[model samples]
Target: MGSTEEERPEGLLGWCLVANVARETLHGDSGLDLQHGTKHFSADALLWIPPIPWDPGHWRWPAVGRHRGNSRRYINMVVRAEDLENFRVKGVYSEALVRSLNGHRHDPAAPRTLQNPWSREQAQSWADRWNQPREPVRIDGRSHPLLSVPNPPPAELRVNGETLHLAHYGTRGAHYSRNPPPTEQP
Candidate 1:
């Protein structure tokens, strides 16, 4: 769906963690099945956990705990193609509900640098935090949950700093193209 009025989509639109979560610390005591299945989630992939924050926009990207508890590295949340419809319909959250998701994208406790505000060590641990594309995903009609979810095993994504598409990943750490991108000639 990376088309623009029948044209192609332009701009580096991917996803970002608009809010920070403290699920491990807050719900560590609770017996919640927080561990996303490995088959479902790749190392440094994304996710769309429940108890969502109220937003006019669907819950987009959330930093997945790569090191778990360490909060250093993370991936984005993935969702089913069917679920996107449910999120945009939800909006407005109470302050108490949103408090669980309060914090800086990076640790505000540390000093701010022009590039990576955190110190070198801090930055290294949370390196994936900086992997975000410069732009946010543009809502075209509606975004399918599968397209939005992290670790999209059933699908793959492509971003050319101007467009993104969903398709089979012919290669790992590859580039972006139209969904169902042309297969690599292995």
Candidate 2:
């Protein structure tokens, strides 16, 4: 018999749902967050979505600690090569975030953040501005460069009621096995 849909491999890029539902005794509410829904990833890199809190003053805990869980639930995907390329081409560029994706430790001075790539319309506007050069203008006692549109940096994809962030890679090590405790001989 041919392989089923579950037997296929995911492409080098694109989004996928990652759910982790490990036992509660070993973890806390943190495991529940990962159990909720979809996520995106490249071949070896995972997208780290920032957590939103109901109260801006209080820091959210679940999203930050999902990694402590030991179990996960996800479906395998079969993706085309071209689709992967599309993601890479349109993907946002962040030097710090990219470093983390490549499995490097985060730099203290450079907190990782996602900057979305320019959209077609936005890019066109930028081009138009550059094409027609003009003198700088003074704003709030500071000279602003001509054609500067201070739009927030681009970020890709907005999941309903959820925030997405870039993943940070840190020191990696192998899991070590411990020796069994001494037992009485029969």
Candidate 3:
């Protein structure tokens, strides 16, 4: 199957949230399972997740909540402009029918608490300002434009006994392994 008009990101940048599925499934018969619905893009097409500051006191956008009592980590990756597909700005963090399971905690009295910080308009403007199509940076005299989230969670996290590194498709920061610091971890 091919991507529909709604599945296209148009133009956006930030992180891509990829489900932990078999490579074949992601590229073959079964496509991506997004918050909106199941949608198919190119094998390289990414599901854009806007970069909001990590609030230690508030719920994180892509919280690594538990699954069967173990930490459930999704593949948070960065991509060059050419690799992007479409953006799912609304309910981007919801899992299936569950709304914003990975977003801000619900508070009915304060309905804004449940909303994502960036609106679609804001995201588009951000993309325009920060994600303009630029030539790849040359590193060590070679083009290495890929850059991952600075200070990502440890690559040592285990999922089903397999070492699961949440960040991919880019270079890790100098403080990558030392982060979440000590205070950030619950």
Candidate 4:
């Protein structure tokens, strides 16, 4: 027997719909003036709606510019099945708002060119790394060892009079701190 809706894996169609609803709701009343781009449901939530895909079929070549057209872009938003249901119940969106999304489901007979690159685990790992807080490099003269000196001093060093902190010095890139380093002793 086919899996029930609860057991069936959530499809990309659902995420795309939720994202559209979120963008419209936020843009209309939130006063945040968010541009037409990816929108996160919450600061702590891993879910987000990616930017709307560009339909190359409608645009001329040079007008397309830097955005290379691809079918994969259509299904890039990853979301949990339960989250979609919860958002619906919480009045984050209405069923009527996304009713048309049902019409856009991919046909089974068509070749599957738009596979999701990330599994749930992979998406969680990426979100964890992206959201991990870095310890700000000490520049307040509290006598902590400097993580590493910036190779080429960061622009903030000159503009804001601050020092850069390398979270994983000699490995990862620099992150800036507003506090300046302690003045050199004679």
Top-scoring candidate (TM-score): 3
Given candidate 3, what's the lDDT at residue 175? Answer: 22
Q: Pick the candidate with the highest lDDT.
A: 3
TM-score of each: 0.18, 0.17, 0.29, 0.24
Which stretch of 10 consecutive residues in model 1 shows the poorest summed lDDT? 83-92
- Count clashes in each candidate, considering only residues at least 3 apart in sequence or on different chains: 20, 5, 4, 0
Poorest lDDT segment (10 consecutive residues) of candidate 4: 59-68
**What TM-score would candidate 4 get against the native?**
0.24
Residues 56-160, model 3: lDDT tens digits: 322223322223222233333332233343333343433321223324454556432323445556666655544333322222233333432223334444434
Q: Considering lDDT, where higher is better, how would the candidates rank from best to worst?
A: 3, 1, 4, 2
Please tell me which model should have the higher TM-score, number 2 or number 4.
Answer: 4
Per-model CA lDDT versus the true structure? 0.30, 0.27, 0.34, 0.30
Q: What's the CA error at residue 185 for candidate 2, in Å?
A: 99
Clash pairs detected, candidate 4: none
* Candidate 2 clashes between residue pairs 3 or more apart in a chain or in different chains: 48-165, 49-164, 49-165, 116-154, 116-155
Q: What is the full ranking by TM-score, best candidate first?
A: 3, 4, 1, 2
Q: Tell how far residue 101 is off in model 3, in angstroms.
A: 6.2
Return model 4's CA RMSD, one decimal.
14.2
Error of 3 at 126 (Å): 2.2
